[model samples]
Target: MNQTPQAAIYSPVAQIDALMPDIAAPVDAADFPQTILRFRNDRAAASVGLDSLSDEAWIAHFGRFEPLPGTLPRPLALRYHGHQFRHYNPDIGDGRGFLFAQMRDSDGRLMDLGTKGSGQTPYSRFGDGRLTLKGGVREILATEMLEALGVNTSKTLSIIETGEALERNDEPSPTRGAAMVRLSHSHIRIGSFQRAAFLEDRALLEKLTDYALTHLYGEVPGDNPPAQLLGRVVERTADLAASYMVAGFVHGVLNSDNINVTGESFDYGPWRFTPLWDANFTAAYFDHQGLYAFGRQAEAIHWDVAQLAVSLRALVEAAPLIEQLERFPALYAQAMARRFCWRLGVVPGDGADAMIAAAVRGMAMSGTGIDRFFHDWRGGVAREGHDYDDAAWDAFRGAIAGFAGVEDARRHDYWTDAAPCSMHIEEVEAIWSAIDTDDDWAPLHAKVAAIRRMGAAHSECIAAA
Candidate 1:
């Protein structure tokens, strides 16, 4: 009888440590009884011994860890705090999660293999540490979709069901499980500094900042070390904003605790990609005030950056960091412009600015699904039937119908091509109205994938064009 593979297989932490000796600690799994689902990283699994295991065997190894031949493992939780929704919260950080150890990947990169939903830590503030299966699924999907869109993001390494049911407020009862794994970098955050600053631990703040600059932002070059580091981080944050804006993504929660100091998109929450171009669109169901609205995301990021700068003011020379912070709008504009160019399949040049602005204005008033409009525009352009600029200009014209003559022509070719971004502004509202009620994500997943594929192809064509 061909019995299924043995369930003794473990995570790749051992092999990863063996490959890179600089890894700070060893291999040990954090047992998260409430683990919702263990979503394994196929890429990472292949490098470790678990690659030979069967599905059932894989599930058996959910939170198991094998020590590397030459490494020592130390499992510990980090300390930090943040303000949730602009109100200062004196305590927060891995309340339900903990960093198991720092290890080196096969590529010689140092990464933290932490586990969320791994039971309560000292910081667990009135909440269960376990992650729900549905939540894990959402996070995996979000990370996958966002990364494919070319945004710098945190990855979902592994997700598994811990077989322990619990209660929760969001869903029906409590069917809690857990999630596990590692990430590229999980050091400090803007809130990390804030926590230290609040405690008057300037020394710790400086140490943390220095560690971050040397590790994460070391590649960035500038004349003044502090200013250069701040500037690089600002540039990355602005770039993130631009990516979020172009993709119509709303990160429901922008709490400082959720923001990564490494400048990568982290802490998945009630995120939603806008189907239409509504300036007021929000992702979280309870965010009635729209503190993190789709339109306000860029501004919110700037706010987060400013908070970080403020926290480190005493430790570093404030002038340079402030200066970098001042450049937020310009940096965001350039990134957004570049992204828009890619989406529209236009080459980088002068005058595209006016056309993009016009297109956005058209989208805002015309009530079209932002994703569909761009996809249709590119599809139309690729088919070689109508002038792309003309279609976009017509869509623009429909918004402000009084304009006429050469002004319209100039707008059409302001970027390139000859058609508008969309053919019909007439039926845009109808499209949005139809999808507004249905939150069943299966169809939306297929649609989002198609949209991303189209965007990628359009980007390639633009680069080549």
Candidate 2:
């Protein structure tokens, strides 16, 4: 917890990471695929003023670093285990990720600035420390798109593509090498709690809970030993689950390692947005058994919360923790309702809210494309023509009928001829294939353009909500 001079100033959108004293062994990044496109840059974010760094400087920049100005950096290897595809994996720490440093933002918020694909460490297991260029690029686009969609996500601070190559089953011959700097609230996960549970270390679990509650959920007041600490954590996690559902997002892999103690979205691997309402819709191709399906995300999150509760069983009383966890579904539903109202540009009191869900459900069941549905709904259009005609209006009416009665019908017309919720018309097929193919940037770039437009429109609509 060192303090540095705040002689330097940065805008709200800009972030700064101070260098650490002790340097670790350098981990070389692999090379890009033949089709991979590379853009070299010295500066990190376009808006940030941080100067371009050399390879030596880049390595130092990503190494374990010191806290800046008025922040703290506790670079401890968090303990955790996860069930990878239903089979338990006992050892999984920051195998390839590290807390490079921590910093205090201008708003006095503590943020964890970390590196992924930097290099191998003691916990490196049997894998390469390098992250593929495609993976890094995918993460960058994912963060930007998610932020635009109004989801709680980690922001990509920088991406460094190296000129190296390696082999990987997940990609095309593994010629890509890269590293990324990400900004997040906390990187501790449910697996960390599960790891402590497996070891029967009540003391370590309690310590972790206290750290998380004190740092992440400071809004929840009360220090009633470990019970309150566990309660706060459970409550926040359930709330986070609700946020995910409202956004039609599936984390794809909600393993204990991916569920953050801060309840903020983390570890964006194999994630996807559902275009239909099937409870079993999955993003990962190898997921033969839809374990992390779109409809089951809430259940998956709740199960993770239960594991967290199990971690607190010995040190903190479990009954209260269970009670708090029980409230997740109801709280999630309410938050989801509010979020849906905002998404559809309706007031919570507006009776139209009721019909909208049914309409959406009907569209999904009837094979209306998920993102396409929203895109078109945003603009007043039907499946038939780009023109907003009576026939198009009739199709909407037919969809609204799925909602049942008049009470639900009120929510039917948020879509007008003026504003259409259009998906990336040219890239619709690409969206479907990106999940199936190796890392692809063409669709992502197109999606980002659509998201930018969507974001600008939301500015005016959010106020209306």
- Taking all chains together, each candidate's TM-score versus the true structure is 0.75, 0.75
Scanning candidate 2 in windows of ten residues, the lowest lDDT window is 14-23
Predicted structure 2, TM vs. truth: 0.75
User: How many clashes in each structure?
Assistant: 34, 23
TM-score, prediction 1: 0.75
lDDT of 2 by residue, 1-465 (tens): 001112223323212121112112223322322222232222223223233444454444543232223333333334468767656788777767676555444344556666677666656889777676667766766666566555667777766655567689875774567777777776777777777778887667666666666556654436554567556566666666755665567778887678787777777777766656567878788878888888788788878777777777777566777777787777677666555544544445433445555555555556765555555544222335544333324445554333322122123333333444333223444553573375554665666565655655544453222
Q: Provide the lDDT at 328 for model 1.
A: 92
Residue-wise C-alpha lDDT for candidate 1, range 1-465, written one tens digit per residue: 001112333333432222222212222345544333335656444433335656665554445433333333544556667778788888677766656545444444445556666666667779767776556656665665566555666656677767667788766555546566545455557777777788787776656665666655545333555466667768888988888877677888988777777678877767877767677888889888988998888888888888888887866677878888999999998888776655544455555556567778666656556765564454223224433345545654443232222211123222243422321223322332333345233543453344344334433452422
Cα lDDT, all candidates: 0.59, 0.57
